[model samples]
Each structure stands twice: as C-alpha cells, then as structure tokens.
Target: MHTTALVLFSGGQDSTTCLAQALSKYERVETLGFDYGQRHHIEMDTRRVVLANLRERFPQWAPHMGEDHVLTLAALQQLGGSSLTDEVAFAMQADGLPNTFVPGRNLLFLTLAGALAYRRGLQVIVTGVCETDFSGYPDCRDDTMKAMQIALSLGLERRLLIETPLMWIDKADTWALAHSLGGQALVDLIIEDTHTCYLGDRVHRNAWGYGCGTCPACELRQRGWARYSARDANASSSP
Candidate 1:
C-alpha cells in the first residue's frame, strides 16, 4: 500500500503545484485548507473548485483521500498582526517587511497539519513555501520550516516528513513542474484560474498573473512570469 500524505493546500500557484506533486507520488493524498479569517474567501473557493476539477480528471484521487477533511484554522484571526487577518491599513514599505506577512502563519498551519497527519496515520505533510519568492516574509525561509518540523515532531511524538518540494525552486521552475505533472492544460488552468493576489483582486489582473501588480506578491509573480516567458523564448530559439 502506498503511504498517505496530507497537503497544506491554498489553491494558489505554489500550493497547487505542490498538490499536483503529491498526486503523482502518494497513493492517497488529502488536502488541508484553513479558513483563517482571511480578508477574502476567493483562495478557499479556488481550492474547492480546483480540487473538484482534479477529482473529475483523477477519480481515484480522493474518496479515501479525505475529501471531507478541509479543516479551518479560524483561530488565526485572534492571532493577527498581518493584513491578511487584520483590519490595519498596510502601507507598502520600499525595503522592510510588507504588510502581507502573516506572523506565525506557516508555523500554526504546519502544526495543525502535523496533528492532522498524526491522527490519520499519515506521515507526510507537504507545503509549497519558497524562500526565493517571498524572502521578505521570514516564515517562508528554510530555517523557519526546519524549526517547525522539529517542533511538530516533538508535539506529535512521532516521526513526520514535511515535504517542501517547491521550497528551493523559483516560480519559473514551479511553472515548469506544473507543466510536467498535469500537462499544459493543467498549467494553463492554474495560470488563468488560480488566485495569488494579496489584495484579493483577480478580476483586475495583468498578464503577469492575478493580484494588484503593485503589491509584493504581484511583483514576485509578475517577475517570475516574465522570466519564464523569456526562458521559454530562448529555449525555442536554440538549436
């Protein structure tokens, strides 16, 4: 029997890529999405829609894959300092941390994911956090994830493998992986349908992907899209 794994899903580019990666590796894979009082529910809604589509494509993906287990981290509202769960108006800092950084976000999410894994006898929890994309956010760093892994192991009293397949890869590589896993069809759907805008605006996005292009999230995404496009252009032109 293949070992079951749980994914820390968010229905965005990174997490969606991670989810697709999980689909390829594990015999059974369940997704864990949190309703942490976000400013908007578009991301969660996107998760539902994407998973539903995936189910149609891969019927064997999740009946025993915990289709009913999309957990909610509602308590994140109580522990808010970032703009995600707070009403505080955030100004775009030119150099320092952006207001989009949610304190203790990955930490809390990973802990809950670990507990869920332990309870369900699943040993792997996969997330798509990247140090290169969102380096401004301290939580996205490799050190932060390592620390959380240790903490979760101690708390759960069991060995758990927290998979970070996209941690070291950049957005361009992520797009490449998406293409490899689910083909250009899935990759196109992810690009056109997924939501990653920090301001929660998808309808008003440019060619670089969704989100307010001025925010840090959009900046990274837009740059990556450009880089990927250029790389593809060069590759096609090469002998």
Candidate 2:
C-alpha cells in the first residue's frame, strides 16, 4: 500500500520545512492549511505559492504533492482574544506567550486533521509545532502533542502517527534540515517567500521572510537565520 501523509501546513518557515520533509518521505502528501481568520491571513496565499513553486521546480515531487486543502474556521475570528485573529494589539505576557497565541488553535487544527486522515485512511499527520524556540504556546508542546495524539486516536477509533519533525529542533536546525532535504534552492524559497510575520507585513524583506521585524515570530526567525549563517560561515572557514 502506498504511504500517504497529511501535513498541517501554515506556510511558515517551519511548516514549509515540514512539507519538504513530507515530500521526501511519503509517497503521497496532502497539505491542510487553515483560514482561521488570522491577522496574517497572507499565509494562505504564501502556502499556495510555495506549493506551486514546488510543482514547477521539482516535477518529480509534483505527483506526490497532492491536493492543498484549505479549511475556513471563521469562528476563530468571532472568538476574538488573540491578536492574530482579532483587531487587538499584539503583546507578550510576562510568561513570554504573546497575545498572538490563538487559544486552542492547534488542538482544533489537529482534531480536524485527524478527522481528515481517518476518513482518507492515512496513518500519518505531519505538523510543524516545535517546542523549542516556540513562543510559549501550550498547544505546541511535545507533551500536548502526545496527549492530543492519544485523544485523537481514541476519538477517531484509528491509530494515527502524529509526526512532529520540528518538535525537538530549533529554527536554525530546521533551516539545516530544509537544506538537507532540497539544498540551497529550497532554503532560498523559504527565506524569500514563506510568511512568518504576525503583522502580515510582506512588503519589508529581511534575512528571514518578510515581517515587521519586531513581532515574536519575526524575532525568532531572524535570530535563527543569524545562527545558521554564523554556523555556515564557520564551517566554510574551518581547515
């Protein structure tokens, strides 16, 4: 039987890397993106662009890059506590979690992904939720993912492998993994095209995709790029 996988893609740097990894491993890979009424709704457009580029640049993987399914969760906007989904200003709490953290967003996304996977008879569901370097979102924790996996399995009555490729790795390691999967070209695609900014500002380009440069998401990405660049420079200079 051909192995099929569903990726919970957000069209961000980490999720894009997860997509690359999925394409490398699975025979058939379908992407699931959410239109959860985020302030950065531009991510949906970015996801489409990335998928198109993948098909155009790597025709060999085109067959594996199955459908890109986008689900609209407009209710998230109505709930309206998160800066990402609401008109509120983005701010980080004393604990480091920004207001951009949508409540139960990942949980809802994973549950929906589980339902899709169960109906499609897929055994694996890939996500880009990283514990390290993540902005204090409880849903992104490894423990949370494990618990969700158990709950999802019980709820669906089907065993599903929740793959978190970026769970343990930081953003810099994520960049290295993306490079290993498809080399510098993939890396460039992610840096230049993927949208990670909370502010949804794509006009200002930086080392790490377009962003306002002050949001937590952009800060983490920029720091990761700096670390990755330094490591690359050191490796090149070494005897």
TM-score of each: 0.89, 0.96
Which prediction has the highest TM-score against the true structure? 2
Q: In candidate 1, which residue ranges exceed 4 Å CA deviation? A: 58-68, 87-95
lDDT of 2 by residue, 41-102 (tens): 89989888888898887776788988778888988898887888877777886677788888
How does residue 188 of candidate 1 score in lDDT?
75
| Per-candidate clashes, comma-separated | 0, 0
Per-residue lDDT for 114 in model 1? 91
Candidate 1 lDDT over 57-162, as tens digits, reads: 6565555456436667777788777777777666654658877777788888888889888888887889988877665778888898888888888887888888
Off by over 4 Å in 2: 94-96
Top-lDDT candidate index: 2
